[model samples]
Structure formats: structure tokens, C-alpha cells
Target: MSNGNETAKGMGRRRGPMGGRGMTPGEKPKDLKGAIGKLASYIRHFKFAIVIVAVFAACSTVFSVIGPKILGKATTALSEGLMAKIRGTGGIDFTYIGKILLFVLGLYLLSALFSFVQGWIMTGVTQKICYQLRKEISEKINRMPMKYFESRTYGEVLSRITNDVDTLGQGLNQSITTIITSVATLIGVFIMMLSISPLMTLIALVILPVSAGLISFVVKKSQKYFKNQQEYLGHINGQVEEIYGGHLVIKAFNREQDTIEEFDATNQKLYESAWKSQFLSGMMQPIMMFVGNLGYAAVALSGGLLAIRGTITIGDIQAFIQYVKSFTQPIQQIAQVINQVQSMAAASERVFEFLNEEEEDQSVENPCDISKVTGAVSFEHVHFGYQPDQTIIHDFSVNVAPGQKIAIVGPTGAGKTTMVKLLMRFYDVNSGAICLDGHDVRSFNRRDLREAFGMVLQDTWLFQGTIMENIRYGRLDATDEEVIAAAKAAHADHFIRTLPGGYQMELNEDASNVSQGQKQLLTIARAILADNKILILDEATSSVDTRTEVAIQKAMDHLMKGRTSFVIAHRLSTIRDADMILVMKDGDIVEQGRHEELLKKQGFYANLYNSQFEETVA
Candidate 1:
């Protein structure tokens, strides 16, 4: 992570767990119950199927719970029949024993069949839930305003879609089944044990509180670590994503060692929390088993004494012992299920938080059709800022006549791009309104408002595709001939034709196969193909060499002939021929004039223009 105080503050600002900020998600959101309720809303669509699954699950657990008791009957019959044969004239009742064994087998098979059906239905239910969640999240991403994404890392956002949703789905599936089955089994086993012998049941129940206490202790201790594990995992993911994306920068600046150390620190933190949570949660089974053994011993001793006193039959004693053993499993499962639910809740909170972010205010009460809008645009006394207390653009105003070439020039943080963003309504002005052809920009549907203007930004974004396809992105319905013509207009056709496959040549990811200048040319071609009445060129020629820049400038001149154009440039020379120049400083226009007039005034624009010449002379 960078040590800049602003960056540090951003990383430390609390949002929630997986918030890409600090450690926790502030507070637990109503704990497990709240998460379960939210998840239930998604699950309600499959209620009929879930209900059937619950029915089958209950039936299966009932069968399983009784199987051991029935098998004990067979054991008793065999032992009694053998004793009869050894004692005197009678032989074993083989037929009766066979019948008991067959009944036990049938019960087990039915249990297995019902369990399979339950699982089969649950698989579909869980997958559909995940599908719906992911679909909604995908749509939500599109509707989310720029501010939401700006506040978080890309990895954090992606993790909500991938990791958090998966966790919710998987946890819901297991927790639902486990809760139903475990509770049913625990109830059935307890009833069977009490029927066999209340004394033995009481003896077995002795371990319940101790086991519960142990489980509660482990869960409470482990949950904090689990939460920490999740936070650290997100931190590590964010760090890794940032580092990998800037691998080139790291190498160039020879900051590889610093990057690695930072990654290792975050990785080490993740490892600690991950293992600690795992180790604590993992101890549950053994501790429960030990308590189970103690219960088993108590049951054995009490049942033996009862059998010797002829108070209970051998078969009943055998069934009671099996119940004692089976009883602990469900309790253990229930404990683990609780843990699973807690983890699920943590994940659900993050996922739901993202889904509920404030979307773009897209309401246009009286929408205007922008299809035939004139190219004239005006900003009147605009006051805006990304945050409430820190206004960046104040009392800003501008008016451009149709077909005028207006150049905005200023220092780096002079609200240049902010002005462009306001013009496009990427961010609405806090007070004033931007108008297009005498209509407030916000009065038009956002999509309609954006269609009248085409933009080529400083960053040249070309996805992995054929050169022709990339250019055609501006107007997806454009024909190949139109694409080629647009390329020619941008002075990109000559170089593109020189490639092995001409226009069909495939660009790699990041478009690293072409030089930065060529990438800029392709973007220009895209804008040309768009053929909108208004155009924005934000340092459109910055990447190209002087020769290419001159050619591109000529092409842009032709493109902007009858269109309203806004050119934001740091290189003062390029905008010298603009129809009007608006010189800005600290969000306000300090000077607005033609090139010759601004030079004669000897104001900020003159000094800014002369600085370039002085630097070249030096």
C-alpha cells in the first residue's frame, strides 16, 4: 500500500467487512437471524421444492434414527434364541431373526433413498438461488453510480459477486439440510432413548450441557478470527490486484522489493487469521466425541446394572446404547451448522450492502428527444464537488455557439476534466444546471443526453478485438466500408493496412501489440465513426509524435468543421487555433479570448503560453 496520507486514510476509512477499508464491517448486522431473513427472501422462490426437501429430509432422519434400535432387536433375538438352544430342548428361531434383519435393511434403504432425493432437490434450489443473486448483482453493477465504484477497489467489488455470493449459496444449502436433519435426528433419538429407559436417558443427557458449553466457547473464540480472516483475505486480494495491475510501474521504478514486502505483510496477516479460525473450528469434532464417549460409558454402566436387575431387557439396553452414540452426532452437526450460519451472515452483509448502494438518479420527469439537438451547450454558474464540504468547481459558466471550437486550458487540477464530467452529467452540478440546445441536460433521459456527443479521452481504451471491430465499437451498426473510411479520416488506415491481416488483425489484451500513438488513432477513428454533433478531445493527440500529431490535428480539423467541439489540452500550442480559448485556474476561468487577444493582454494565458517556449529554449 502507498504511504501517502490520503491513500492511507482511504484504506483505513470504515465501510464494513470486505469494505476494502478497515478490519470490520462496523457492526454485525442483526447477526445470523438478519442474514437468514435476507437469504430467505431469495430462497422463497423455491419454497415448494424446499418444503418437499424438508419433508423428505425429516422422513430420512426418522428412518435413520430408528434403524439402530431395530438392528438391536435382531441382536437380542439372536442372543435369546442361542441361549434357548444351549439351555435345553429348543433351537434358535432363525426365521424370526431373518425377519428382523430384513426389516432393518428396508429401513436403512428407505433412509438412503430419501436422503438422496433431498440432496437432489437441494442442488437445484441452491444453484438457482446463486444464479438469481449473480444476475441481480450484474444488473446492479450497471446501475451503480460512479461514486460507489470510486470508493472501493475493483477486487473488493468483484469479490462481492464471486466470493460472497458463493459463500451464501453454499452455506444456505448445507445449513438448511443440516439444521433440518440434525434437529429431527436429535428429537427422534431422544424419544427412543427415553422409551427404552429413563435412567439411561438421564445419564446420557448429563453430557449435553458440557458439550454445549464447549461448542459455545469454541464458536465464540473462533468467530472473531473468522471475521478477521475474511477481512484480511479481501485486503490481500486488493493488494495483489493493485500490484499485478501496476507490475510494469513497479519494475520501472525499481519498487519490486517494497511491493513484495507489502504483499507479504498482508499475506501473513491472512494466513494467521485463516489458520486460527480453522484450528478453533476444527477442534469441535474431537471435543464433542470425547463428551460422547463419557456419555457412552455412563449409558453402558447404568444399562448393565438395569439388565442385571431384570429391570430392562437386553434388546432395550442395546437400543439405548446405540441411541446414546447417535444422539451426539446431531448435536455436533447443529453446533457446526451454527458456525456455518455465522460465516454466511458475514458474507451476506457484504453482498447485500453492495446490492443496496445508491444507484444513479436517472429519473427524467419531462424527457426531451435529443436526436435533433443543436450542438450549442452552456454551463451557467455551476457549483459542484465530489464531496459535500470540498467544492472544486465554483461559479463556473461557459457558453459555446453551434459549430464553435472551444479549448479549455489550465494547470493539472484546474477542474478541466471535472467540467467535462459535468457537461456529460457523469456528475451533476451541486447548484447550477448545464443545458443542451436550450434544454436542461438533466431533462433528457441520460442515454438520450449522451448520444449527441462523442468523446476521445486521454486514456486510449481498446479491447481485445480486430482493429475493424474496435473502430466499429463507436457505432456498432456501421458497415466495414464506413469503418475503413473513419480510420482514413483519423489517419490510422495507412498503418492498419500495413499489418499482416490488415483490418482483421487481432489486438491482444491491453492492446500492447500497437504503440500508444496508434491506440490513440484507433480511438479517434471510433469517435469519427460515432459522427455525433458534439465532440470532446481530452489530450487526444498527447501520445503521438510531432509528425503524427500534425497529421491528426489536420484530420481533427476536418472532423470538427461543422460540430461544436470542447478540447481540453495541457500542451498550450495545440489549442492556439481554437475559435475561442478559455483559460482556467483553480476551477474558475481566468481568461477567455482568441489567441492574439490573450497574448496582448499579458495575463495568465500569456505567461502559460510563454513558459513552453522558455522550457524549449532551456
Candidate 2:
């Protein structure tokens, strides 16, 4: 199949993130600009390190020029001075020769030392850049909206953070400096070659322009392949994430071979692109060398003719050959740098795209710093939908006084959870307002507004840490005594005590080490521990066994006594004690009253109650 990106429009207003249900496929981000400038800004953070590397590189290049000059002088002196001594007159000027040889050796040593220094410094710079970039990317990921994650796979993002960024490190550390220094070194060598014998320089360089043309052509071709290769790698990574996350389903369906085939297709695409890129890029060195060797032969032949005719000395011809030998290697190095930049340019674009994601709107101004907000919530003709074209809640309204227990019961997709999301400002209403304590929630800082309420979602999220740490996450500054107290209050401390380490038991990745019931209890503990004036729960007790569910109901009773709680659950029997039950269909409340009062009304809530009542009798 063709790439989705290839077909995506550029900079289209389709504003949905990857993951879950997102917006319609809008304009693609290829319109994202200045990937090179973004990457360069990252390098700029290490200016001192760059300066040191560049300075050393310049010094090494300058020192490199002395090699051909010193060798030529020594050759000239040896040939003439030795002949003079052979004719037996002057003392042979052996002292001057010794000093010149010593200086040449010193220059070589200095060049070697500077090379080492530059490498050492650049390594440090690259590592730090990696650290900072990763840190910044992680922060951006946290702040991005849920919709953004809905549009792409986790592995694609991971590839950008890990593989893509590492590829750019080579360029930042050494390749750029190497190219700059090599250019300087090459120019110096070229001038010297010309001064020795301009006629031979002209002959040797006949093939140089052709070699350059071939390298440039290959670089242009390789760049496109490199970009395609990186994108293919991202697709492959996304496939891997999907396969692994759904490994159980694939196994149950006995589709291992099918999975392997799918994987192979993406893998092969990556391989083909990368292989083509490497093949073309690899040819650069050999082809340039072939032409360089031809240049060398031409120079050698022309210089010999001049030497024999006494038009130029043997020493000049000897030095010219050395310069010619050195020229091609630096030229090849430059070609490699160009190839490298293409790959890094693509990677930097992806990484920066992630960095520039629009964070969830936290644009509301900070409000009064009151310690406790009275739980008064009102949905005043609020309208909302994940997508604008499809309205989920239209002109809906609800109001709850402080400390009221409101249970929302509805058919699936009736905007139950969407209500909780809007109150938390995970999203804003398309029209109208959700108010808390007589103020629109959007008027307060999102963090402070969220602090007014607590949530226990259907899928509880526990980080890789101890149970104590996870609970402490509810209130970062909570004391140990308080954490244990909240755990006991949520009826989770009983299980915590049974574990080997009690509250200190470490949660494995995604909390897979714990039972589902235990996970739910911990999440409930978190909501209780939060001590918020407003509480929101979705399928809060769906994981608990009947007996534990009863126990949790008791725990929630104490926590719910003095807070405005909005509970969304499929289990209608669980919310029988709520002060009011609102039955919803589509996006409107069809029935609203106390549980018994709604049952007396024989509306949607009563019908839902009767359905569960029949399931029980069966």
C-alpha cells in the first residue's frame, strides 16, 4: 500500500492527534518549516564547545600546509647540499637540515594532538545535545492533547525520539567540523601544487571537475532515498507497536504468519530504500578515488617530463605528487558529509515536528488563590464534539449544587465521559460554558481548575513505581501517614498489607504485576487522597468483585459525603444511592431526578434498571 503521508494535504486544518478517535485526516505537516534552522538552534546551545572544536580544526588545517612545504625544502636541501659535500667544499649545512626536520616532526605531532582534542570535545557536545533534546521532547509529549496521540502510533514517536535524534548526533559532533577543516586543508594544498608547477596542476585537475559532478549528482539522488528510508523505518516501528500491543488478539486469531507477512512488507520497504541510499552514497568514495588516481597519474607523468627537462626540480615534482595524493581523500570526506546531512535533515524535521505540537489549551488566566473551592457545577447549554461536523452534545444543560451526588446513566456514546472531560478542561465546549463556583472553568488556570476535581478513569494509569509512590502522586507533598490513611479509607490498605512489601510493593510497567481489582482500589485511593471538592469517576468499580465492590461502595460513601461527585458507569445498580440520577439519550438528558424518583417516573433510568434487574433474575 502507498504511504498515507504521500496522500495527505500539507498544513490542512485537520487538527487531531494520533491515538484513540481523532479528527478527520486534515492537512499533513510537510509544510512544517526550517528543520535545519531548528536543529542548528539546538547546536547553538553548545557554542563554546563548537568554538573549541572549530579552533582546533583550523589550527590542524594550518599545520597541515607545513607538511608539503617542509618536505619540499628538505628534499631540495638534501639533493643540492649532499652534492655540494660530494664535490668537497662547504661543510654541508647539516645543522640547518636537522632543525628543519625537527620542526616538521613537531608540526605533525601538533596536528595529531589537535585532532584528538577536537574529537574529545565534540563527543561531549553531542551527548549533551542528545540529553537536552530528549528532555524537551518528553516535556512536549506530556503537554500535547490526547487528540494528537490518536493520529499516530507510539512507536513512530519513539523512532523520532531515539533513532532519528541519534542519527543527527554524528553531524553535530564531527562531520560539520571535518568538512570545514578539510576544505581549508584542500585549498592550501591546491595553492601549493599550483605554485610548484602550474602546468602539472592544470593537467592533474582535468578529471577533478568530472569527479565533483558525479558526486554532486549522487548526493542529490541519495538525499531523497534517505528521507524515504527514515519514513519507512517509522512506519515499520508503528507496525511493531501495533503488533506487540495486540499480540494476544493476533495469537487468539492464529494469525502469526499473516502478522509476519505484514511486518515483512514494511521491513522490505525500509530495506530497499536504505539499501539504495547506501549503494549510491557508498559509490561516492570509490568513484572519486578512481578519478583522483587518474589525476595522480597525470600529474606524475607531466612532472617527470618537466623534471627531466630541468624546467622544475625533482623536489618540486615530489611535493606535487604528495599534494595530489592528499587532495582526493579530503574531497571524499566532503562528499560523505553531504550524504550525512541529507539523512540528518530528514530526522531533524521529524523531531522538531514533535517539539512544535500545540499543547492543550492552558491559555486561561490564573484566578483567585482560594484553598478550597465549593463544588458547584453547571453546564449552561453546552455543546461539544470531538469533531465539529458531528455534534455529540447540543444545547444540553445541567446544574448541581455543592456536595450533590449526581449519577449520569446513558447509552454508550451518549456523551457521559465527554461531560467529565469538558469539566476538567481536557477539551473546551464548542459553545456555552461549564462553570465551577460561579466562574467558567476556562477562566481559571487549567491546573488549578483540575485541582478542584479528581478522576478515576475506566483504565487506571499507574506508573512504574512503588504503590506508595503511585498514591503519593495524587498529592506529591503528602506524608507517609496520610498516604496509608487514604489507602485504608479507600479499602486498598487491606490488599497493600497482604503484599510482600505492603504499601512499598513496586508496580511493574503498566501495573501488570497487580490484579485488576487491586489496580482499581489504588486508583480509588488516589481520588480519595486528592481531597478535591469535586470528584469524577468513570466505570470506577467495573473491575471489582461483588464483595470488594460492596467494600469500595462503603469507602466511596465516606469520600462522597461532602463533595459534588459525577459518576459514569454501566452498572446501573451501583448508583442506586445517588441523590439524583440523570438518564440520557443521544446528547440530551431524558430523565433527571433522585434514583427512586426516576424509578417512579418509569423513564429511561427505570427501563435500564429493569434490564439489569432481569439479568440478575436470570
162-254 per-residue lDDT for model 1 (tens digits): 778887788888999999898888899999988788888988999999998998899878877666666666677776667676678778888
The TM-scores of all predictions, comma-separated, are 0.91, 0.89
Which candidate number would show the highest lDDT if scored against the true structure?
1
Off by over 4 Å in 1: 1-20, 24-33, 88-99
Whole-model Cα lDDT of every candidate shown, in order: 0.82, 0.78
Q: Please state the error at residue 366 of candidate 2 in Å.
A: 5.6
Score candidate 1 by lDDT. 0.82
TM-score for model 1? Answer: 0.91
TM-score of 2: 0.89
Residue 441, candidate 2: C-alpha displacement in angstroms: 1.5
Model 2, 1-618: lDDT tens digits are: 001111111111122221221221221236334888887787898888888888898788778776877778778788888788888965467787888888988998898889888888889988888888888988787577766765666677788788888887876665767776888778878888778888987887787789789988997677767877777778777777777767787788888898788778777878888898899989998998889988988888888899889998877877888888877778888888878887777777778878888898655555755355788889999999889998899788988999999999998889887787677776789999988878888778766776777777656678789999888778878899999999999888988999989888888976889887788788778777778888877787877799878877777787788989998878998898888887888988888988889888887888888998999899
Q: Least lDDT summed over 10 consecutive residues: which range in candidate 2?
A: 1-10
